[model samples]
Each structure stands twice: as structure tokens, then as C-alpha cells.
Target: MKVRAITGFFFVIVMLGSVLLGPYVFSVFYLILTSFCLFEFYKLVREGGFKPSRESGLINGFLIFLFFAAQCYFPAWKFIFFLPVCLSAVYIQELYKKTPAPFSNLGFTFLGILLAVVPFLFFHAMAFMNGSENFNSHIPLGFLVMLWSNDTGAYLAGRAFGRTKLFERHSPKKTWEGFFGGVIISAVAGLIFSHYYTELTWQQWVTVAVLISCFGTLGDLVESMFKRSINVKDSGGILPGHGGLLDRFDGLLLAAPIVYAYLYFISN
Candidate 1:
């Protein structure tokens, strides 16, 4: 228990520091994060008796993330046109390998990219989401705060009042009680954050909070499903007690993209 608490404390400090430091730190942190996630994902898939193109997928996934980042930083929409061509290299490389399950290889390679790389790419936009051409840490910081709040609330509430299972097959411990508990806590947090982070109104922050709670829970379930299917307990052991990068950021996988879409629509 002490080890877990210690690891979690340092983990939170590093993540929050990177996000708060500035764009370069945030970008570099997430870039390394995305790469590690994709690498770990491919490793898990390989453990499931499938050979994925690890090298090509990693390189292409990194490039794709940079491509999106470039789209945000530079006036380079035309550069995005190269993404398809780069992705195609995965297929093209697979053709020459003479692997029996070429198609399966192709599918999982792209899956890693789509699942790990694509979702996180939108996080870059959150910093510049206001259309003011300036970077604001609060947007992403609020997201982290709400996400952590939901998780903390669910843990406490679920322990205290959990009864009915939310998804018995994928995640046996989750309960509807905990789910709603997380929502209520996150909603309250959103309302409170509105005063300090004035980028959005109270209502908007609440909406974002609800989205994180709902989708974030779903994201946890999805990762649980993946691990269950693969017959693994945790995604990786990078964190002493927190399981893996995927386990930690599973909520962001689905929530970040959806929140990005929501913010984009409202801002534009």
C-alpha cells in the first residue's frame, strides 16, 4: 500500500508538471507517452498469439502524431496528405515479409495506430482549442483534474456502497453505484473549476465533466476487456503500482477525442 501511494504521488506530480510547464514539455511528454502506449499495445497483441509489425507501426504512429501536432503548430494542412502514404507503408512492408497472416498483421498494426495514436493526437488541440492562437494549460489541466476526481470518487463510493455490478464480464468490480458517484463528484468539480478556469462557463465545464465520467468509465471497461481477452493482469509494469501507461491513461483513450470534438464545435 505504501509503495502504491508513493508511485502514484510521483506519477501525478510528473504528469501535472509536464502539462503545466509549457507546450514543449507537454508535447514531448505526450509524444513519449503515445509511443510507449503503442509499443505496449503491440506487445500485448503479440502475447495473444499474433505478430504485429512493431517497428513500422511505431515509426508510422510517431510520424502520424507529429503530423497532427504539425497541423496544430504550423500552417501545414497539406502535410497531412502524407499521412495516408506513410500508413500505406505498413501494408507495403507487410507484403514483402511473406508472413502467412499478412492481413491480420496489417489490421492490428493499424489498430495500434488508430487506438493508441489517433485518440491522443487530439489532446494537442485542447491546448490551442480556444481559437485565440495561444496555448492555455487550464483546458488540459481541468481535464486531468476532472478525470482524477471521477476516478477517486468512484473508488471511494464503490468501496463504500457498491452492490450491483456494472459489467461483470469485462470488469467484475465496477458497480452502477460507483458510476453515478463518479458523475456527481465530477459534475461538482466542473462547477467549481468554472470559477478559476474561465475559458468555459459553469455549464460547459459540467458538460465536460459528465462526458469524462461517462466515457472515461467506458474507456476503463474497454481496457479491462482488452486485458481480459489477452489473459494479462496489467498492461505493463512501468509504474511500480499503477499497472501500465495504458492502464493509467485508458480513460483518455475514448474521452479525449470526444471532448475535443465537443470543444471544437462549441468554440467554432
Candidate 2:
């Protein structure tokens, strides 16, 4: 218990610091984060008796993130055009490897990018999402706060009053009661953030909170499903008590894109 608390405290501090420090720090931090998460995904897939193009996948995934990051810093550059060439390399490389299941390799390699990298791309976009190409820490930081609030709220609420299982198949410990608890807490956090951040109106922030709570829960369940399919308990053991970066940020996987879309529409 002490170890979990200590690890969690440092984790929160580092996450908050990364956003508050400014664009360069945030970009570098998430770039490394995206790479690590993709690596972890490919590693797990390999453990599941399948072979994914780890090298090409990592390179392409890094390029994909760089494409988005570059857009924020250097929008005029045509880095996006190179993406197809990079992705095509993945397919072409498989033609020569003569792996037992080339197609599966291809599928999981791309899946790692889609499942692990794409959402983070959206997340990285959130910093400069205001349309001015300027970085604002409020949106990303507030989003993380609400996400953490929802997780904490659900845990506390579930422990207190949790009878009805939300989804017994994928995650049996979750309950509808906990879900609502998370929503209520996240909504409150949104209202609080609106007072200070002002990046979004109160209602918009509340809506984002609701979106995070709902989709974040789904994201957790999806990761849980993936781990179960592979007969593993946690994604990895990088964090002492947190299992893996994926386990820690799984909620952001689905929630980030949805929130980004919502914020983009409103900002425009």
C-alpha cells in the first residue's frame, strides 16, 4: 500500500510537471511516452504467440508522433506525406521476413500504432488545439485532472456502495454505482477547472468530464479485455505498483481523442 501510494504520488507529480513546464517539455515527454507504450504493446503481442514487426512498427510509430508534433511546431513542413512511405515499409519488410504468420504480424503491428499511438497523437494535439498553434496547458492538464478524479471517485464510491456490476465479463470489480460516482466527481472537477482554467466554459468542461468518465471507463475495459485475451494480469511492470504506463494511462487512450474532438469543435 505504501509503495503504491508513493509511486502514484511521483507519477502525478511528473505528469503535472510535464504539462506545466511548457510545450517543449510536454512534446518531448509524450513523444517518449508514445514510443514506450507502443513498445509495450508490441512486447505483449509477441508474448501472446504472435510476431509483430517490432522494429518497423516502432520506427513508423515514432514517425507518426513526430508528424503530429511537427505540425504543432512547424506546420508548414510536409512531413505528413512521408507517412505513407514509412507505413509502406512495414508491408514491404514483411514480404522478405518469411514469418509464419505475416498477415497477423502486419495486423498487430498496425494495431499497436492505432491502439497505442493514434490516441496519443490526438492528446498531443490538445496542447495546441486552440487553433492559434499556441500551446495552452489548461486543456491537457484539466483533462488529466478530471481523468484522475474519475478514477479516484469510482474507486472510493465502489468501495462504499457497489452492488451492481457494470461489466462482469471484462472487469468484474466495476459497478454502475462506481460509474455514476466517477461521473459526478468528474463533473465537479470540470466545474472547478472552469473557474481557474477558463479554457472551456463551465458547461463545456462538464461535458468533457462526462465524456472522459464514460469513455475512460470503456478504455479501461478495452485494455482489460486485451490483457485477458493474452492471459496477462498487467500490461508491464515499469511502474512499481502501477503495472505499466499503459495501465496508468489506459483511460486516456479512448478519452483523449473524444475530448480533443469536442474541444476542437468548440474552439472553432
What is the C-alpha lDDT profile of model 1 across 202-225, one tens digit per residue? 999999999999999999999999
**Model 1, residue 199: C-alpha shift (Å):** 1.0
List runs of model 1 lying over 4 Å from the truth: none
User: How far out, in Å, is residue 37 in model 2?
Assistant: 0.2
Candidate 2 C-alpha error for residue 77, in Å: 4.1
- Score candidate 2 by lDDT: 0.93
Per-residue lDDT tens digits of candidate 2, residues 86-155?
Answer: 9999898889896889999999999999999999999888888865367999889999999999999999
lDDT of 2 at 98: 65
TM-score of every model? 0.97, 0.97
Candidate 2, residue 181: the lDDT equals 97
The whole-model lDDT of each prediction reads 0.90, 0.93
User: Where is model 2 more than 4 Å wrong at Cα?
Assistant: none
- Itemize residue pairs with steric clashes in candidate 1: none
